[model samples]
Target: MTRHMPISETQDAPPRRRITLPLAPPLEQRRLQLYIALLLLDGAAILNGFCIASWLYLGRFLDETSLLHSQVMLPIYWSIALSLQVYTLTALRRPNFARARAGLSLIGAETVLLFVGFATKSTDNFSRVSSLLGLGLSLVLLMWVRALVRPLIKARCGDAVTNTLLIDDGGTPLRIPHAYHIDAREHHLAPDLSDPHMMDRLGLYMMNMDRVMVSCPHDRRAAWALVFKSANVSGEIVDPEVNMLGVLGARRERGYGALIVASGPLGLRARAVKRLLDLALAGGAVLALGPVLLLVAVLIKLEDGGPVLFIQKRTGRGNRFFPIFKFRSMRVERLDSTGSRSASKDDDRITRIGRFIRSTSIDELPQLFNVLRGEMSIVGPRPHAIGSLAGEKLFWEVDHRYWLRHSLKPGLTGLAQVRGLRGATDTETDLANRLQADLEYLDGWTIWRDLKIIVNTARVLVHDRAF
Candidate 1:
């Protein structure tokens, strides 16, 4: 029995047995506890598996001469297990227990073990037979532990999951255990396929949910697919004909149905790593470019004596507004607040230094501050000013798909920018083309993708179209 903490002992039991109250913690806290417990359990299993394997092959625990050797090996095993990302595979995102994940993770563990065996000359300490058996046993225990725990987690967090559609006009019993059945006729949060605000709310709701069963127009399938998978939510639907996957590059994430899908990609620790990288890179850029930025600031002040930074509101994730920073490369007095006019080549409103910065894409440098502020990613869809236009029409008026770009934080530079789609939307075709690139970035996002964009962006920095 897995005993959840935030519990207290009761004095009614005899001898050694004591009763504990079901003092359930907050949802997020409980989820964190579950993750920590899983890591600890896997770590312990690795140690135990090694002990058993050692005895089987060498007739002693770790075949070590001293307990000190075992203690040193204990931390090493834990370190190796963590570095292999063994816990990550357990952060499932599909509808089933992915026993395959354990096998894949074991392969990774085995490879890492082989590297360590050679590096540390572990073959000289323990026989090859012991090493292989120990690894096999550890992974076996990992899979076995997950097989037992996944069901319990599903049952416990079941309201956050829906195996069957609970949407109804009225009076339908939700068949799935702990499913949050909605009387669609009266439920304010019921998904409205046509309303963008409603879709946003539903997407927000999905951040707390795992598998969600929804019914909407067939044409709107792509929108829901972007919303659900971007949020990492998955589910089963009775209507087999309603599939919107691969349209905008959304793929069905199998093996996560039984597990909770927290918002975004790459699990908790992976996200932390990405976040750390963002801060490091952004912070480093600010420091590395300090002299260039100061020079630009002086030049801007010398020309107009206005704000060095052109702080403007741009749409961020979930259509939330955040201030994006740029070096003011335009005459402050002539800046277009409505986004009605797009900058063109050799615009008179841009001063000499402005022309240089704007052309060199140096004006976008201050967005590193936005990245450091957590208002933007180092790479993603570039944040467009509100009321940004495509020809004579506002971007949102161009298509509903335009709004889907807000699914992630806007970036300093993006797939569209690096791919020569930067500066001026002169036609609906241009706007549509950029939207496609943005969708591509969102659906196929990775740290590597970000790095590639960053590298590619340098080549186009002085392009003619930028101004």
Candidate 2:
């Protein structure tokens, strides 16, 4: 809700400079501690709610058979809890009004329970009164859990105040009661715009801040926002003339000041929905493709008697490394894990079956496992190997902004791939164009777009670049 914004934007800046901000340890630790405490209490509440509901559900017959059912339902219930984000929703930093909305969240839990019960065929087995009673108890216990944890959260974090950075141009300062405001217009905080040393110090100072408010002119807000978001901080333009109705989020509230998420492709709820869909679809695909997978394995093994699966480390979400699996296409000796060079159309290292599999994209079937493991997505930007290059330079070296593509998980097929940007990016322009499409995908990410990309990828399987 309360995001950071850059305070200053040197309008007539001579050159762009990079700023490195170190994270604040004390604040980060306190935040993590509160989150852990909230999670533990939520677990406790769910357990207590389950016990109370079991008593009413089973009535006079509390036997071991019912216990088995309960065991079966435990994970489902846990997942229901997670999907509703019960723990996170009840965070004490949120106002009491927000905390009270836990009841509304239960609606989501109830909806999940209905589908899960039907999927597991427990709807017939479980009593109606029991289910209703249990859900009611959960609602109560969730509130009680927050009530118990609220003091602990407040005691450690101290009234939910933010370390705010205010960049006003010697005008009226923000009068936010809970914010520890640091006005950047002062020389001590934000020094000469051209000084590299000052920039480094400013970066470090901003890390200690929770929010950055730039008191700039209305039209310049967009430019200031980019600068702040580039630094991976929440950016707000403190413009009195700018109307929030149009620019701010539809769900934006009348808080102390206007704040919106910066650099996010989608809202929190949308991301959750996307993640759930990925898990469900990826799981189903793995199950349905079992026979095809086995046949591919056999074909790969019979070709050269080497490893049937190719396991290579590739860049993943947040630039993290994860092993990607594919039906081994090339011979063991010729595998290019680093992606140092592009695979030529008639590369000799590729086996006969490998060529067929790669052409048909059967080689990429193993990546459903990565999707299942949550390291990759059903659709997004395609991750390259760490040593992947656009001609002479590494992909990242071609454009420093390329790292932004890693914000979301790498996909089995991506926006770029569907748009015909797959295969080797042989030039800087090639890589830049792919990055542009990838960034656009990130900016306007939606579940439907993922589905379309997947469909498009399927259509392009027999293309010339598949080799």
Identify the candidate with maximal lDDT. 2
Residues 40-78, candidate 2: write the lDDT tens digits: 665555555655777766753353433444455455645
Stretches off by above 4 angstroms in model 2 are 1-91, 94-146, 149-261
Consecutive 10-residue window with the lowest summed lDDT within model 1: 253-262
How good is model 1 by TM-score?
0.61
In model 1, what is the error at residue 154, expressed in angstroms?
Answer: 11
- Which residue ranges in model 1 land beyond 4 Å of their true spot? 1-37, 40-203, 216-276, 298-306, 318-320, 331-338, 346-353, 442-449
The estimated TM-scores of all candidates read 0.61, 0.55
Worst 10 residues of 2 by lDDT: 191-200
Q: What is the lDDT of residue 198 in candidate 2?
A: 45
